[model samples]
Target: MTMLPIQTTATAPVATPVATSTGDPALPLELLELELSLDGFSGDEASFAEAVRQAADQVGGDFLFDLPASGLAEDCLRIAALRVPKGENGAPTIVFALLDAEGATIRVENPDETTKDLKRFADAFVDVLQRI
Candidate 1:
């Protein structure tokens, strides 16, 4: 697995779980910040699910990919994740997707690594919307 390293000033506090956590693994990362928006995602439920998955594919370090909920627009996309402190060479245990954001499905598996990729994924998602 490719390890994406995020440049940072200090390590962020281990994030709290959003939905039900697989297991509360410690995710100590710096307080990184990034924002993305759909602007106007005039699409059906299936499109929404696909778009969310595509965005997640860009941001690596994923530990789990649960079955998509029946209704995406009505369901909060949740991705459980975890990694050993050493690196990808480490095992993928399990953690919570607890970052609080509005109108965005987010789960930073490894805060130190996935920050940049998440931003890239967000940009790509917007591009996907514009193309549609």
Candidate 2:
């Protein structure tokens, strides 16, 4: 596994999660911040996912290619990536997605909602996203 180092500056304290109008999960502050940090490397969900997958394929290493939810938009499928942390203050994990570039699906997953698959793909090239 390749480890990408993340250094962050202090921000406002995280608030409690509230239900959204559509009843979809509300994004946590951590996930939101992660998305903001990766803005340059991100774009339309479908395009970003395809690019990441292709980049990983070119390197030809282990990549986790499972989608977390069923009924998710097929075009947007590959672009979504997430990582659930094991505890508070653990390596910052990300729940990344782009719905019409609106970020409607980025949120922490419930235990029942999670799949037996990785939340994101990993490779050394991921460093480019981090350093930028």
* Candidate with the greatest TM-score versus the true structure: 2
Task: Kindly state the number of residue pairs that clash in model 2.
Answer: 1
TM-score of each: 0.26, 0.31
Residue 60, candidate 1: Cα error in Å is 2.2
For candidate 1, write residues 2-119 as lDDT tens digits.
Answer: 2244333333322222222133243332101110121123333335444433433433323233333233222344322222223344333232232222323343333323333443
lDDT of 2: 0.36
Clashes of each: 5, 1
TM-score of model number 2: 0.31
Q: Weakest 10 consecutive residues, lDDT, candidate 2? A: 12-21
List, residue by residue over 1-132, the lDDT tens digit for candidate 2.
122334433332222233222323544444434434333343444455554344333332222343433444332333344443423555533333423224323222322223213332333235556697
Candidate 1: give the clashing pairs: 11-29, 11-30, 12-29, 12-30, 18-98
For model 1 the TM-score comes to 0.26
lDDT of 2 at 31: 40
What local lDDT score does residue 130 receive in model 1, on the 0 to 100 scale?
61
